[model samples]
Target: MTTNYKTSFLLPHDYEIPTFNYPQYVLPPVPYNYQPYTQDIWSANVIQPLKTKITAPAQCKFDENKYLNLFSGEFNECYYDFEIDLKEIDPTIQSISKFQDAYKTIEISNLNNLQIKCATPYIENFINDRNVNLTYGNDNCEFDDGLLSNITLKKEGISQTDDINFENTITLYTNNIKVNDIETKYAIAYTNGLPSGDYSNDYITKTKSNVDFLLQVTKLSNNDNDKIKETYLQVYYTNDVKLKIRFSKVLVAKLIRMFGYLYWGNDKNIVIDINNSDTLGIKNNSDDPVKIKIKPR
Candidate 1:
């Protein structure tokens, strides 16, 4: 019975586990084609084209034939009359109806052709060297007439956006004949941490007792008279903070006195010349140390 049970316990020989076949995974081929990048037209290229014609503004052309330099005076004879004819750069621009001071166009004196006509010789001498440029109107044109269709009239050194403060005194030594006179007493304040250069312009004017017109300050590293002429307010700082100013031309002083500060650039900083003055004096009113090379506006 045991042998029969063992024989019955044995499993069928044909019965076996099933097998599965998985498909092969093949990768795709790498790409071979390439493309180049391109850019569309820029706004500047579209708006402005190369080789485009530009209209130029009319300028004052120098006239050698009409140029005159006369010398006349009583005792101290100096170069008196300096006359020049400024024709338009465009020969076609003729019959100028009106002309005025280019920068300060408000001072219209019914003159356009000639620039300078000073009574005294020294004054003429001072003005002739400056070589002022003028703007004029055509026969049927107004004061605001233009030469080029696209360009606007530009007064080079004049600023329309500046806040100008006008007063009676004009300025201290620069304007007032009474105060600016050689006899008149001028004083400067010596304080720690005061403004210098263009910033000091207002500060120097306000801090001083008799300053009526605006005062400009410049820094001087060397004692050069030629360099001094290059600016209105020249400054040099030392261990002792004292103001050392040298004036040159009386004619220049008078011109500045009448016309106010002559701006060199658009900022309206006054332009000065040492050659315009005759008397050279040095004075020290304060003991403040010299602060050199402060930038001016």
Candidate 2:
């Protein structure tokens, strides 16, 4: 006869393990959204947003280089460096991106606006045919001023909030930008490990605007031609008038090195363009370097 006593098991049947929902952190070694582009920098047709940090020594905010951004003025910005694990996409892409350069994006708004720029590592040689909406997917968000702060990626598995090092997460630089009639607020993103594009704005700046753009370029730098006796060019601009330029049906971008002129038209057309440099050469001009200040007529 078998005793009908309940079999005592090593484990209790009534007690069950609690379920813990782990927050999925998109750390490295994750799938990457691969953006395809040409591999050449010269022939590539890409117009990436310019960097606040002038990379070209030959050109500055004051100077004119078709390869540089003359309209990019001084503003508060930051850079976020990240590494992507793209082995699944391409075996060659590791730690850094396939291309070493940082991909960049910029968004502009009035003082009421917070300009946001997003960047990914990419080759400048790309066709806008398949423009990468450098946006995030998996609960992923697009690049913006507050993006980094919202998404905090610390260590693998589960990481405590305190473990994150803010300093290492981002590098910040704040400058006092003089605001006048219209204060332009900007947010810039500079990141590698994804994809990038290029403005290649040299003597004349090239942008992604499909309409005629009018911007006033002001010379914030003194024509000192520093101790090195080397002349550097720098300038700034306003975005309010660009719309008018577009409506006028005159789509032309020009960087004038000549002299200034006065316009009599009611629609002043403050943004003016004149001559193109015959020589990219730096001239040993006046003892006081010439800094051209552009304003509305």
Candidate 3:
């Protein structure tokens, strides 16, 4: 009892909890009006995403704004040209006389690489006997009526000239017994690349989906059976990010269709209505894409 020591211990006590007040979040003001979207604002925010995704995939992020910026940028248009030649010849008088007794033959070389084909009912009366004393006339030997029997073409071994590139050649041929009476003419058709069906599935569409870009032909607005000299091509893309990203898939598909007809030697320039039914739904998903499909306006 004399050695008892004093002991003290701490005890738990209850206290009122403190109240917390969180500040309200405020969204930043958008630079443009938020309403029925205009082409100007939408272009800055939407369709651009589609193009950026397809054009530069590695540099693209899922962010709508950056994609839109890429989409809004301009695209380079492809141009190409093709050259053709026609040659004429006359066989020896003895060859023509011998042909009367047999099926006369005329051979044309230098045509193995072109898409050349002749029309129906080839012309006749191309050969005459030496005793007939018939005078050959240039007007009588026209290429427009030939049957186009055989054709061949070879790529001209040369580099690109003045932004002018060689695509492929097209040759037309026919064999007339009257070789001396035949004449030939060369016809050339020109083009300003091919048309862009839609920009949705374009290479850039995956990154910049929401943009609404348009390709306009501002010059050479007529292709109705006339020679085309020069034409203008204009590209329109949106600048908005959110809109661009949201519609990336659709935009990619559209862009693929938009330039479906662009090739090396398509020199036709005419009023092509973007809303034509035949011009719709031309794009599809594929590992490798190619532009094919020629349309007449």
Candidate 4:
């Protein structure tokens, strides 16, 4: 069967063929709407597939559109809030330099005996001393200057990190040779060799292959009178494995570059397993036409 491509997915309503392998890397819609479905075709970024729903509705019918999880490189630089599938990204990365400029200060009470501990992979150590005793108004010390000495930090360096790609942490400890009152101001940042770009935060690239994992559109289809009440869509990606699917009726922003398209046979039985979903229904009007929009995220 010949699948004629338009922009994103091959024309769904009129097209029918055996399970065709349409590569999902988002690309300019091919002017020539046909590609061979070779057996060896496989996308590197694959979202896991789902089982068909049973018991009542043979296929999923919903009034709303949905979305899947795309690894976005946008978030806070201090903590990891989400997990970007490593498979979704090219992991063999080297730093042109690192990112993240940090500064902190800790007031040490009970200086008679004190122990503050921390660690970092960027340097053998961020502190010159790990164990010590002191008085309230006598000792003020900074540690980023002295190290096992392999890596060096600024005079105000407290910890070394690579926020350039992702957030890494540096730990500190207070150590020996102190007399009285110590005010430790850990004013630090990693900036000397940072790559030159507006992009100073962790991110993915346009070069890596991008693919849809799974696309699920849950709809509530009600007969015009006493049948089922129709619903609007809210799409979501299922990461059971990681390849993703885009949905109809809504557009989302993607973190990865766009390329090839995800084509399908006549089977749109793509329903996902979502819990606690807020269901919204539209009166399945027997008159007006309805349409769903699929977008990338």
RMSD of each: 28.6, 27.0, 33.8, 37.1
Greater TM-score among 3 and 4 belongs to 3
Cα lDDT tens digits for candidate 3, 6-124 = 89775544556687999999999874321211111111111111121123221211222222221223332222111111110113113323222222221221111111111111111
> Each candidate's TM vs. the true structure?
0.15, 0.13, 0.16, 0.13
Off by over 4 Å in 4: 1-69, 79-190, 196-257, 261-297
**Model 1 local distance difference test score:** 0.19
Off by over 4 Å in 2: 1-72, 75-80, 84-257, 263-297
lDDT at 205 for candidate 3?
Answer: 22
lDDT of 3: 0.20
Runs in model 1 with CA error above 4 Å?
Answer: 1-121, 137-237, 240-272, 276-297
lDDT scores of the candidates, listed in order? 0.19, 0.20, 0.20, 0.19
Best by TM-score: 3
- The TM-score obtained by model 4 is 0.13
Worst 10-residue lDDT window, candidate 1: 45-54
